[model samples]
Every structure is written in structure tokens, then in C-alpha cells.
Target chain A: MKLLLKKGRLLDPTLGIDFIGDLLIEEGKIKGFGREIEISEKDLEIIDCRGKLVFPGLVDIHVHLREPGEEWKEDIESGTRAALYGGVLRVACMPNTKPVNDAPEVTSYILKRAREKASVKVYPIAAITKGQEGKELAEFGRLKKAGAVAVSDDGKWVADSSLMKRALLYAKNFDLPVISHCEDPKLSFRGQINEGKLSARLGLKGIPASAETVAVVRDLLLARETGTPLHLAHLSVKENLPFLRWAKEEGIPFTAETCPHYFTFTEKEVEGYNTNAKVNPPLRTEEDVEAIKEALKEGLIEVIASDHAPHSPLEKEVEFELASFGMIGVQFLLPLSFNLVREGLLSELKLLQYLITNPSKVLKIEPPSFKEGAPAEVVIFDPEERYLVTEDFIQSKSKNTPLLGRELKGRVKTVILEKRIIHL
Target chain B: MRHLLDIYSLSSETIKEILELSENLKEILERPIPKVPTLRGKLVLLLFYEPSTRTKFSFERACKVLSADTMSFSAKGSSLEKGETILDTVKNLYALGVNLVVIRHNLSGTPHFLAKHLKIPVVNAGDGIHEHPTQALLDMLTVKEKLGTLAGLKVAIVGDIKHSRVAHSDILGFQKMGSTVYVTGPAHLLPEPKEAEFFEIRPGGFKICYKMEEALRDADVVIALRIQRERHGEPFIPTLQEYAENFGLTPRHLELIKEGALLMHPGPINWGVELSYEMEKYPFQVILEQVENGVAVRMAVLLRLLSGD
Candidate 1:
């Protein structure tokens, strides 16, 4: 349908456009913007976005929608609706499912379901090996050709150096980016949270940052040797952030993404609140959070994916040692992110680049834009909207979101995907 | 499943099940082809940081009964003497994919730490003076073998209770299974735990005659605890002459008790200080039976817990 978003403050960072004008849409493409545009009689709808700022829809390359194999927690329909509600138009789902999602068939199954039921586009990341066992590499070329976006062995690491080097070289042959969740099992055994005063006080096992840093150091050397494009997911351990900084300064063809919780919450949150704040990289101290925030502001972190790992409430309500490893984030990703920019912790330009340009580049896509004749995928949000992020407000099937009870500024007012108004 | 880490972590039901299952294993032990295929594909590594001849041999024999392989390592000339962290050494051993580890250490509560750190099961042969619960279980097995029951028998666990893991584990298991348990030792050796109902201290000379007469009067079961000489900074007994007179149980001392007062000790014993050399082979003395029961008790626990049945 033809629609016009009139008189909005347009900040399309992709085109470096900041103007107050009407954006005309036709056939799911931006027909014109920033000038007085006469709409055709065939124009279907026009809305006044008087004080809103229109932006290019954000893309997240690391998300777990729990589809195909385990849908009791979330399906493609519900998860994508929540994504649209949060102003995310494209999301790449991780492929650690019931059957490990190692083959081309599972990857194609995920793509077909996403096409049939999801409001937004979905890209499935295939497992690095058969059953993600890290024993042998999967058919990366066939999986990628079957629409798997990238390769990852998410829940576990590919430990054997020789096997990982081969997987990296094989993915390189297929031009598939290798995403690694770097963790050394021996170093991380029995560790419940970050090793520090807090973990000691609670009598929980301590996970040292060395567990993360050593893995990062190994991968960095592998990336350097193989000349393969490696992406680090949920970079929390502060010592590893410096390597990403080094990777950039040395012009290594590598990239990394840090989650919002790594910058927003610290290990102290898990100190008294119990298991809800517990996660895999295990939260770190305020010093680490400050380093992540500084890194995000400095452009060392290429993307800020939510890493939205959803789990059932029963899974998290048990003993701290027994609870699951992830927290849901998609429903509150936008407001929590915009709060960072509004609070002056991050400049608007940095936020835009992290949410849009960097992820587009990481996923090797034609960068999204709000320019004339571009795809009409945009997010209009109010910078001053105030609300408390609570379970009552979230649209996801699971209530494992860490943002619950957090008061934040800003809200996505409208989402225009394919000339369709999917949100309000 | 092949390891027995601690007694407390093993449930009462598991203990009872193992004791009952031992009746079946006894006949098999007498056969020429005594081995079974239960653990044919498995391997056990008995690594000890402390001295243990009884438990070490029993575990190795138990592995043979199940037709499994065994590798025993002591601290005498191993890499551990070169100062490697226990976690590192264990991880390296685990890399070799060893299925089970039987560990005995000199520190109290060391088994719990190992259990938490390792993915595999760790059997605590003995950990300091805290627990030798399996030893206690086997001791009970020996007593039950002669007496044919464990109901309301007054069992006095005499001598050095504080320095005795066997005594500590026995006092609890005995009381749990319908036996009146008591701790009899010099007040210095068995100091009352500020508040306890199980002990009555005899803070003076426990000469062989006097202590035996007191312990023998109406006792249905008399368990003489082994005095660990290494625990004492000074002489544990004032004099060997004085200890022989006071705490030692000779043949004459045994005559003061009832006809059959079921004599027991966790052996590798001092025949003179605790029991006379002849008393060690007394018909009712079932010391070896306890060692045999240890494996059966451990197997019941391993099967119940790991099988999730």
C-alpha cells in the first residue's frame, strides 16, 4: 500500500540525512523524502508523525527465537511480532536447537517457517559441526547455499584447534562468516558466576575472566593465521575487549558484538538478587561494564545485538546453580537501547551505527537506509517517552527478560516494514 | 558408580539396598569364575594422598569382581610430589578419559571439594577424621554377620573417638539403624562437643583392666577404635606399660565380658594396644567381612544414583 510519513524528524544515519520533511512510500519503497512531495491519487494512507524521529530499521545478528525444535518457549510468529513491536525488522536466529541444526535440511526448515509465519525476515545461523559436538565440521557450503546465514557452535565451543582451523578455512571457501561463542570448558567448569568478591560471598563457584580471555586469545591467533573473518558474540570479559581494539588497529578482518546487559548490568546485580541475573559469560564488575560502555562509545564494538536467549520461567526459578543460562531481551531491546542515547551514555551517532550500519556490515548486507527509493523499513520513536519495562508490557512468550522493572526513556512509536504499519 | 565419596551423601535406602545385595555376591565370590561383566567397559584409578592398605586393596578387588580395569597411584613417586594442583592433575587424568576416581586424602572435607570440581564420581576412601562412613558401613556388616540383627543392641565404640573417622561414621550409622551407640574414651581424646548426648567422658586413666571391665559389663557389642599415633603431638598414652594396663584388651579382659560380646575393630590394628594377637582371629571377630561389604554398599549407591531408576 502507498503511505506517507509526513513532517517527521528524519535521521537516516546510512545516508547522513537529518531533515524535517515527509517520507513518501510506494510499492514498499521510499519514493521521496525531505522535500514537498505530491502524493499520487493511488496513495493509500498518510499519517502525521509530527514530533517523531524516523530511523532505518535495526538489525540484530544474534538472537535465539527457540523455533523448529523447541517452540514451547517461543515460535517464529510470537518472537517476530515482539521484534516488530520493538522496531527490529531483521533478526538472525542462532541454530542450537533440539537436533543441533547441523544439516542443510534443518536450516531450510527454519527459513521456510520464518517465511510462512514471521512478520520480519529471519536468517538462520547453522551449527559448526554435526550435532554441534565439535568433533567434525558440518557441510557449511550446502547449509549456506540452503539459506543458513553464517556458522556457529553457540552453546559449546569447538575446542580442537585443528578441527576449528579446518572449519574456518572451509567456511572461508563458502564465504560464510564464522561466529564463535568462545569458552574453554576446563577453565569454566563449576563456575556459576564471574569470579570475584560477590561469587565468593554467595559461595557460588567463580568463573574467572581468564576463561573468556584465553578463548579469545586462541581465536585471535587462529583468525590471524587463517585470515578468516571471526565474530565474537556477547563480549563481556573486559580483558578481551582490548583484543578487539587490537584487532581493529592491526586491520584484522575480524568483528565483535557485545550485548546490552554486559554494559548495563554488573556482577553486583547477581550478588543479592540471586539467579535471575546469572548468565553464561557470567556478569562482571562495574569496572568491566565501564570498559564495555567505553568500547561501545569508541566504536570498538561493531554491533550491539540483544543476544535474546529466551527460557521458560520454570527453568529460571530453581536454585542458582541449577537455573538456565540466558535472559530474553527482544521485547525491550529498543527502549533500553534508546535510553542509553537519551541518558548521554552513548552519542546518538554511536547508537545508530551500532544498531544499523555495523550489523549490516557484519552480516554483509546492502546497508539499510531511509533514502529516497530505499526499502520502506523504518522505526519512528519518541526520545522523551517514559515507561517502566515490566512483564506486563512485554509481548514475548517468556518472561525471562532482564529489563523487567527497569524505568527507561523512549519508545518505538511506529514501525514501517515493506510499506506495512506493523507497530503503533 | 564405582566410587564411594562419602556416607552422608549416600541415602539410607541406598545403604540398606547394598547390605541386602551382598548376600547374593557372597556365593559368587566363592566360584572359580568370580568376575561379572558389570564394569567390563570401565576403568578405575585409585589415587591416594594418604596411606591406606585396607581400602586400596578392597577397591582394586571390587574392580576385579566387576571385570573392570584398575590403575593405582600413590603419592610416593608421582607428579603430585612435584607440586601440581589437584584440579590440574585430575583434569589431565580425565583427558585420558578415566571413568572413576577413588581418592583418600589427609584433609577433612576434601572429598566434597573434589566432587564439586570433577564431572566424574569421586569415592572418598577416607577424608581426615571427618568420615570413613564406608568403613563404618562395613563394620556394621561384620557385626550384623555374627549377631544376625541390628535391633536395640548396646554398642560401645571405645577409644579416641575424636581422632577416629571410623568411630565418627560408626556412631551415626549405628544409631540410625536401631542400635544404642556410645563413645568411650579419655575426656582429652573424646572431648564432649560442647553439647552432645552420645558420649560420657572418662577423663582419667583408662588402663586395660579398668577400661575393659567398664566397657564389658553389659555390652552386647564392643568396638575397639584404633588409636592413630600420628594425631598426638605428645605421647598418646602416658606409657606403653600404663596403656597396656589401662586401655588394652587382653584375653583375661575379654573374659570379663558376656559369652559373645561381638568384638570389632577397623583393622591393620595394634594387637597389643587394642586387642590381643589371638583375639584378632576370634570366631566372632568379623573384621574381614566389613572390608568385603564396603564394595557391595558402594555398588548399590552407584547403581541407584547414576541409573536414575
Candidate 2:
């Protein structure tokens, strides 16, 4: 079969391709790309992508598919379907499921399920510790061999310093990236929201910024000492800036990531006790939001992922403290990250690199590009299209985003993954 | 207002109205027949998720005195133990023609959550370490009854300000009525000053007095909060003994306050930890009067919320 995407502004930062172009696909593979591709074959299919932005499908390194357990919230099928609509063709899901992805068997189960059910590519991230209890380390070698792209105790941090240091070194031997969920459980114990006047006024227990910075400092020092590549996930506080800066100056082998919500909202979102805005490393202050945007601009924070934690009403419809910390974002990842570009914090190509290449590098995988003979993993986005984020608009099973009922720009009009053409 | 969720949401005018209503209601309590027919057939559901004696009984007593029917639901041996969500449990009760809900949950904003979903009014009996709206109202009523007005009074709140919902509400309530609130406790016990600033509360709404004596000196009212031993598992204080010695209100410390200053405690007090037992005998102490005024204040709240006046 011959397929032609005509006259779209194709942008691939990896290949330095930025121009009005046409891309040709044959037999589910990229045939070629040029200023114009005229194909008059017998079985020719052509899609006019006029006035649209086309790029490689986004790769989100952090997402929670909620499968293997708690499929009621989000399974691989629903999660990946949401991702596809957001122009994300690939996602590395976190390991903090009902029964955490600690053992090789769990990782194998996730991959096997992804093979049968996932609409997009799913990379399973195994837990760094057994059951993510922060007590004993998981078998990194066996987990990596089972198709695990990384290891992380995502929902909880490895509080024991010696155990975390050893896990970093041990995961290094297996070539598996160590992703740290930086939070001191003791400092953030029973904490409901960001520690500030908001928490005070609401009378909810506060999670101090030191909870994140303390763990972040410890992890950076551990990475510096061990010389192992480390990835810090969901950094929210400005207090982590100096430590992240010192690590960069020292030439530490580490990559830092912040989510779109970290730059989008602040602790004030919890004013009315809005449970949808409730997130782990709870939404911080406006100052922290500016710092995150600045970090993304300076490339101190390289990757912008959707820490797409989804929760059902069972978890979210309770009291603020009882409500689980999370907001589903895999579906809105691209549109929300596009805000950074809209706000002039990042250029279009730089934003795409953060969504595509930088995250692919974190996972140590080949990013999707319009190379000849490569799989046709592409996204056609209407940058000017605006739509309200509603339950009907969301493809994820859980409709638990604070952005619900709000209008967002940049809609994914179509997604091309190999032979399957998904029109959103 | 449909719901009495927190003191922060109540205006000074509304607070004055409630206090005036309580003063009138307090007269009924001293009469031969203490019952009123204000809410003759209305059913008030007392949903207490945490263990409580005073708050639950106070709400029930308020309901009975107002001639409103009352039903109690405790977390123990209830459907909540069977893993039913609080919303579901409250909805099931709401289906039974409940006129109002007076809820006390270990989680903050549980009453607000219920109030959002239910058409019937919801009253916050006490929620977590968040607020005890009625407790503050009753305390304010006691102060007004004794001192003639809530305005221009100096109030001192001592002990476990961070964990005490009573302190949170009292600070907002007392300040709303034009009183200056001074809070002093172990450094860890007091909330950050930014907490008050976030509410856009006026400057001097509440001051953090580091020294207990500084807070007590020339104070018009002194409220001593109970220190929960369970909360001390994190070593918020070096020891209860050390806390009693330094921050506790003893007879010696009482001399620092104004001659006619009122001593208050939202009780179930840790006898020696926050207050010296000997100090309880002082004539200016209004701890028992605070409890007596609790019923009147809650009665006023139920009438205001349910009767739509």
C-alpha cells in the first residue's frame, strides 16, 4: 500500500529536517520525504496535511499504565490509546502498580500484555526494590533481561541511603537506568499538600520542600560517588535547583525531568480542596513553576514527561487527605507541553526534542524519525485547534485531570504508527 | 449559609448574627422547658468517623434542645468498616430524608466534600487537624458572654497550634470579630506565619509569641489546647515533662495575664502537660462554661443552616 502525507511542515530535530514537505510511506515503512512527493500508483492513498505541524510521534519516558493490577484505573490498552491520541507513540510506564513491577515475572507479564493489548509501544519499568518497600533491592539483571527499560521505586523513595546507593551501583552493572522518586518519607509523612501558607490556611498537613530536596541532594551525591547514570523523576521544588546546579557543575552523570503539571499549576490549585490537582510531590508554588520553566529553557531539565498517574473516583472522590495523589495526563501530554512553546520558554523543535529525542536518550532507545525504511511513526498536529478537555475528549478510562472542563490548544489530528492510521 | 464548614468562610456579620442567636438560645437552656420547636421534624445525622465524646454529644444535645430528631453514625461497627466510601455512606443516609448532616471525620474537608454532593446542609463538627467550626463559635460565645464583646480583646492560644483544629478555627474566628490572637507553643507546634498571610488575614490578626509569658502578659483570654501524646511520636517536643515545665500554664504563669483575663480550654486536657491541675480552680477560668456554651452555639448553627433564617 502507498500512503502520502502531503504539504505538512515536517519537523524532525534529530535529522535537522524543518520545512514544508511531503512524506511517503509504503508497506508500513517510511519510503522518503521531500518538498513534494508525487505518487500515482494504482493503490495510492493521500492525506493532505495542510497547515499542520508533523513530527515524530512523542516518546514519554514516564507514565503509569496501571496494568498487571488496578486495571480499573488504566490498563495498557486504554493508557496507550490515550497516549496515541496525544501524539505519543511510545511510553515507559512506571513500576508502582498494585503489585509493583519488581520481579522479572511482573516485567515479562507487562510486556506480554503490552504485546497483546497496547495500542502504542509500552516499555516496562521494573521496581528498584522488592515490592518498592525500600528495604531490599530487586534483581536488576533479571529484570533488565525481561525487557525492563529502567528501574524505579516511583511512588515511594528508597529512603535508606546505603540501599539506594547500592541499587544505583547494582543497576549500573545491568545497564538499566535508575530513576529516583526523590522524597524523604519522614519529612513528608502524612503530608497532604505543599508546605506553605496554603497548607496552613487549609489546615492540611504540609509536605515541606525539604522532603524533596533532601532526597534529591542524597541521590545526587550517591550518583556523583558511584558515577552511575541517574534520572530524577518529577522534580517540583525550587529548593532542588542549587543541588541540581552543583551536580551539573561537578559533571555528574545524571538527567533531571519535570512534568508538565509542575510548570502548569501551583499549590493554590488545592485551595478549594480540588482533589484532581492532588499529586505526589504535590503541586508547588508559582515561584517553583517559574523555576521549572526556566530549567527547561536552560536545558538543565532535559525531559518533559507526563507523570501520568491515573486514579478512579474511588480514590479521588474522598476527602483531600484521603484522596490519592495523581492526575491523568498521558492524553493531554502534548497539548500541555506545547504551552512551553506557546509561552516562548522553548522553541518548537526544542520542545519536540524534549518530548522525543531527550526522553528516548533517557531510555537508551532509538527515537522515531522520518528516515528511509524506518517505521512510519508520525503525528499530524493542528497547532491552532482548540478544544475543551472533557471526559468525552479523554480516551483514558480515568477522567481525573484538573484540566478537565478547560480549553487547550494543539490537538493531535492524526497519528500514523506503522500501518495503523489513527485519526483523532 | 447552607453549610457551616469552617470559620474562615464565615463573615464577621454572620459570626455576630450566630453569636446573637446563641445568646438568645442560651436563655432557653436556663428555662423550665429548654426545648424549642424551631426544627420540629427535621432529622440531623451525626456522622462521626473518628472517636469523639464531646463533639458528637454536643451536636446531639444541640439537636435535641432544638426539637430536631437526631441519628448517630460512628465509624466503629458501621458500613465504613466494610470498606464503604464516606460519600457512599453519606449518600445512603441522605436517601433517608436527612435534613442536615453534622460530620466529624479524621480527614480534613470531609464535611465540605459531603456538602458539595448533598442538597441538605452539612455542618463540620470537627475535621482532622483542619477546623472545628462550632468549637470556635462556642469559644467566641463564651468570650462575648464574659467580656461583653469580641472586639478589642487580646487572646492568647497556647499548645499544639499546628495539630489543633480548635486553634485554627479560633484564630480565624476570634480575629474575624476584631480580636488580636497571640499563639505560643513549642516551635514545632505553631503553624508558619505564612498560613495566616495566605488567608489574606489582616496584619496582627494573629501573632506568634515565642515565649509563653509574652503571649500571656496582659492577655484578655487564654486558651490552652491539649497536646496529643500520639502526635509526639515524631518528637515534636523533647518530652511532655519539658513541655509542661516551659510552656504549660501554671499558677505562676497565670500571674502574667491581666487581672480579669479569662482562662479557657477545649478540654479532655492532658492534666499537667498543657495546664496545671491547680490552675483549674481559678475563678476566672471558663473551661466548663465553654462546654455549656457549646450546645447553645451549635443550636444557633443548626437553626441558621436548617431553618434558612
Candidate 3:
């Protein structure tokens, strides 16, 4: 069977193509695309894509599927469905789940479940250390062979410098990427929000920006010394920028990622004790937000990921300090990142590169593009569309975002995956 | 006036009204029969998630003076200790036809959380280090009773200002009432002034006095807060002796203040830590009067919130 997508603005950051064109799909693979494709097949299914932006589906390098445990919050089926609604066709799940994804068995379990239940592709990121205890490193070779894309101790940092150094060198032998969750637990101990006047006024303990910068500096030095390519996850503070710049200038191989919440909100979001705005490496000051946007624009920060930590109201609907950190973000990743383009920080294509191309490169996978014989992982997005973020709008089982009841521009109109066309 | 949550949001006129009501209530406390039938049928729930002796007693006495039924629920031997959430426990209490909730918890914004979820008026007894509205009101009442006015008074709050909910409330309350609030303590015990500047609700910010004498000089009132020895584990202060020597108030310091200036402590004061034991014997010391005023001020709050007076 053949399908024709007629007259849409196609954006392929990988192929560096941006123009209004028609795309053809045959047997669930991209057949060909040009200004106009003349298809004379009577059995061809044609979809009108006027006034829409068509692009390769997004690749989010950080997400939490919460599978094999905590299924009540989110599992592979529900999480991938959320990703599909957000126009992301590929995601790398973090290892900070219940029982922690450290061993090959957990990694294999995630992959097997994803193959059975997920609508989108799922890449399991195994823990860097056994049980994420930060003392002993996990078996990197076995985990990589079990289909794990990378290793990370995401919820906690590898506090021991020697242990982290060993893990960096050890993961290198297996050709596995090392993702570091940069934070000093001692500095951020019992911290609720960004350490500043807000935390002081609110009377909650503060997590100083030094907590992230200190960890970042250590990780960068380790990566430089070990010569292992490192991926820093969900960096939220401005103080880390100078260190990141210094590392880049020193020719250190590293990729830095910042989430939408880091650029979109600040500590002020927790002004009324908003639990949904509480996150680890907590939301920082307005200056930090500006610095993150500038970093993205300057290409110093190459990837924009959704650290989509899902927590039910059981964890969120309590006292601000007692409430768990993080908000569900996978579903809002694209629309929120699109605001970067709207604010003129980055062009639409460049924003797409951060969302799609850069994240794919971090995971060491081929990005989805409109090449012949490539899988038809495409998305139709309506940039002008506006919708309110409500419980029903979120496909994730947990609705724990500060954006709830707020209207957002841009939405996923349709997603074309191999053998299925899902309209959202 | 539905909830006595924090002094930061209380207006100058509102604070004056509570003080005036407290003045009238203090007169009733002097009566042979202090009991009033105004809120005889109302039930005030004292849900203290944290251990508190004075705050709970003050609220209970206020309830008794107003003739309102009181029910006390401490965290020990309660559903809270059995892994039940504070929200669920509060909701269960609210379902029992409780009229008003006076909550104190270890976490900041606990009262705010209950106030958001509950329909009946919720009073913040004390929530973490965030606020103690009634305590601040009572402190304001004590000062006004002695000074006759809250406006234009120089008030100095000394010791453990960073962790003192009373200090947090007093700074905002006094500033709202037109007092220039000055705070001095161990450097680590003092909160950054920039943090308070972010609070737009504050009528004016407090002054951070690095030297105790700077805060005490010519001040109309001086409040010494209890320094928690438990905080030593966190490196806030080197030792209680060091804090007392450097920041504590004594009779010798009295000469630095105005002739008729009063010394206040949101007791139980750390006798030798925040204030010298000799401070209690001084004629200017009004520690007992502050406790007396606590009942009256809380009565004013309960009456205003419950009877809509």
C-alpha cells in the first residue's frame, strides 16, 4: 500500500531540508519526497497536510517509564503513548525507578516490555552503579549487551570521585555513553527549592546552585581525564555554564542537556508552595533561565530533553517539603521547546535539532529522517493551535505539572510510525 | 480574616484591629469569670504535627475563654505516626464537623496546604520555620500594651533568626505596624536580607544588624529567640556558649536600650543561651506578659475567624 502526504512544510534537521513538499510512504517506509510528487496509484491513501509543519518525530534522551514497578504512575504503554502525543517517537528511559534498573535482568525486562507494549521505541538507560548506591559500578558490558543504551545514576550523583572515574573508564571499554546526574547531595541535603531569597522567605531549606556546579566541575574533569564522552543530564543552573564553557574550550568531549522546565520556569513558580514545580537540581533563578536559553542559542548546550519524572498525587499532593521532586514533562516537551522558536532564541529548525537530532546523537542512534527506505517516523504539528493543559490533555497516568490549566501553543496533530498512523 | 496564616499578609489596619481586639480580650482575662458564650458551640482542632507545649496550651486557653470546644491531636500515637498523610488526617478531622483548624507542622506551607483544601477557616499555629501568626500577634499585643502604639517603634529581634518562625512572623508584623524591625544573631543564624526583599507582602524590610549592640542601641523593644542546640549538628553555630557570649542578651546590655524599653522572649528561652538567667529578674523583662498576651491574642483571632467579628 502507498500513502501520499500532500503539500506541507517538511523540516528534516538531519538532512538539512526545509521546504513545502509532498512525501510518499510505501510499506511503512519513506518512499521519496520533492516539491510535488506525482503518484498515479489508484489504491494510494492521500492525507491533506495543508498549513502544517511536518518533521521527523522527536527523540527525547531522558524520560522515566516507571515500568516493572510503579506502574500506577506510568508504564511503557502509558509513557510511550504520552510520547506519541508529544510527537516523540523515540525515548531513553532513566534508571531511577523502583528496584533501580542496574542489572542486565532489569534492562532485559524493560526492553521485553517495551517490545510488547510500547507504541514508540524505548531505550533503557541502566544504572551506572549497583542499586545506584554510588559505591560499586554495575556490569557495563552485560547491560549494554542486554540492550541498554547508556548508564546513569540519575536520582543521585556518584559522590565518590574515584568510583565515578572508574565507571567512566569502565563504560568506555563497552562503548557505552555515561550520563551523569550532576548534584552534590550534601549541598542539597533536605533542600526543597532553589537556595536564595525565595527559599529563605518560604522557610524551606535551599538547594544552592553550587550543588550542581560542583558536581558538574568534577564530572567534566573526570570526563577530560578519562577521555570518555559524557552526557550531562538536566543541568538547571547558570554557574555550571562557565565550567561547561571551560571544558568545551579545553577540548573535552561532552554533551550538555537542559530540560524545558529549566528554561521555562524559575524558583518563583514555587512561590505559593507549588509541589508540581519541585524538581531535583531544582528550578533556579531568572538569570539561570536566561543563561540556559543563551546556552541553547549559542549551541553550548546541544540537547533539550524532557526529564519526564512521573509522580502521582500520592507523592505530590502533600506538604511542599514532603512532596516528591519532578513533574511529568514528556507530553509537553515539544510545545514548550517550541516557545524557544517563538521567543526568537533559536530558529524552528535549530529547536528541532535540539529536540530530535542532538538527542539522537547523544544516544548514538541514527535520527529519523525522510530518506528512502527509512522508517516512516514522521509527525504533523500545528504550530498555531492553542490548547489548555488539563488532566484529560495529559496522556501520562500522572498529571503533576505547574502548566496545568495553562494554555499552550503548538500541538501534535498526527504521528506516522511504522505500520500505524496515530492522530492525536 | 478567615485564616490567621502569617503576619506577612496581614495589613496594618488588620493588625491594629487584632491588637485592639486583643486589648479588649486581655481585660476579660482579668475578670472573675473570663468565660464568654460567643463561640460556645464552635470546635477548635489543635492539630500539632510537631511537639509544642506553649502554642497548644495558648490556643486551648483561648478556646476555653471563648467557651469553644477544643480537641488536641498530637503527632505521637496518632494516624500520622501510622504512615497516614497529614492531609488525610486533617480531612478526617474536618469531616467530624470541626469548625476551625489550628495546625502546626514541621514542614513549611503545611497550614497553607490545609487552608487550600479545607473550607472552614484554618489558623497557622506554627508551620516549620515559616510563620507563627498568633505568636507574632501576641508579641505585637504585648508591645502595644506596654508602649501604647506599634508605629515608629525600634524593635530588635536577636538570636537564631534563621530558624525562628517567631522571628519570621515578628519581622513582617512589626514592619507592617510601622516598626523598624532589626535582627542580629550569629552570622550563620541570620537569614539573608535579599531573601526578605523578594517578599512583596512585607510593608518594609527588616534591618540586619551584624552587631548585637547595633540592634539594641536605643531600641524600644528587644526579643531574644531560643537557640536550638540540635542545629549544632548542621554547623549553624559552633557552640551554645559561643552564641551566648557573642549574641545573647544580658542585664548589662539593658543600658544600650531606651530607658523604658522592654525585653521579650518567645519562651521558653534558652536561659543561658539566648538570654542570661538574670534577664528574668529584670523589671524590664516581660516574658510572662508575652505568655499572658498569647491567650488574649489567640482569642481575638479565634473570635474574628469564627464569629466573623
* Candidate 2 vs 3: which has more lDDT: 2
Model 2, A331: alpha-carbon shift in Å?
0.9
Better of 1 and 3 by TM-score: 3
- Residue B110, candidate 3: how far off, in angstroms? 0.6
Instruction: List the RMSD of every prediction in angstroms.
Output: 17.2, 1.5, 1.7
B1-309: candidate 3 lDDT, tens digit per residue: 778788777888999998898888888899999988989889999998787889899999999989999998988899877899888998899899899999988889988899889999999988887889898999989998899988899999998887888988898888888888988888767875546564324444578889889999999999989875543346677777887888888889998999989999887767888888888888878988899999999999998999973
TM-score of chain B of each: 0.87, 0.97, 0.95
Question: Which CAPRI quality tier does the interface of model 2 achieve?
Answer: medium
DockQ of 2: 0.68
**Among all windows of ten consecutive residues in candidate 3 chain B, which has the lowest summed lDDT?**
B196-205
Model 3: per-residue Cα lDDT over A1-424, one tens digit each: 8888899999999998999999999989999999999979788988889999999999999999999789999999999999999999999999988779999899999999999999899999999999999999998999999999999999899999999999999988988999999999988878889988888778888888888999999999999999999999999988887888889899998999999999999888898788999998799999999999988988889999999999999999999988999899999999999999999999888989999898998889999999999999999999999999999999999999999999999999999997688877
- For lDDT, candidate 1 versus 3, the one ahead is 3
Give interface RMSD for all predictions: 13.2, 1.7, 2.0
Candidate 3, A191: how far from true, in Å?
Answer: 0.9
Candidate 3 ranges with C-alpha deviation above 4 Å: B193-196, B199-205, B229-233
Tell me, by lDDT, which candidate is best: 2
lDDT tens string, model 2, B75-165? Answer: 8899978999888998999899899999988778888888888999999988888899999999999999999989999999999988889
